[model samples]
Target: MNPAEPLPRAGYADVRIIAASPDIARRVADVLRRCFDSTEQRSYPAGHDGGTRLQLTVDTAHPAGPARSWLAASQPQRADRPQGSEA
Candidate 1:
């Protein structure tokens, strides 16, 4: 949740870790276990036959921090100019 901290895990709603860094991976498993019933937490993987996995995955994701700063710089602010200095 914190920018300083990296996201090394994914897919907690489903029973699969998808990808893990092996550092906070055990924490990820704990989160998934809490999200689902304890029984389901014990079973199921990426895709299970006759089972449902929401298939929620991230692809082509970019960090928004730098993008937001870039966009902010492009906006026109009256403070940038003084008394209609230039066009």
Candidate 2:
């Protein structure tokens, strides 16, 4: 699919991941697959860079686990005290 084209709405997203190798690109896609329902990855050459590009569609509405949990897990906790509470 053309990268310039607009993707469909309603939880559907067009994901394009570029990496130095096909295995790296597919590895990234695999991580997404573990979180969301997605289509098979389509591989392509990334211009003169000789890198690999992977494209796929993912349905965010149907996440494999509780939505936003991953986001929370990735957040960094404050190093300071708990605010108004004892350290």
Predicted candidate 2, C-alpha RMSD: 6.0
User: Model 1 over residues 7-60: C-alpha lDDT tens digits?
Assistant: 534432223454333334446655534334333223224343333222222221
| lDDT of the structure predicted as candidate 2 | 0.85
By lDDT, who's the top model here? 2
Off by over 4 Å in 1: 1-14, 39-87
Q: Which stretches of candidate 2 lie over 4 Å from their true place?
A: 1-4, 66-68, 71-87
Find the candidate with the highest TM-score and give its number. Answer: 2
Every model: Cα RMSD to truth: 14.2, 6.0
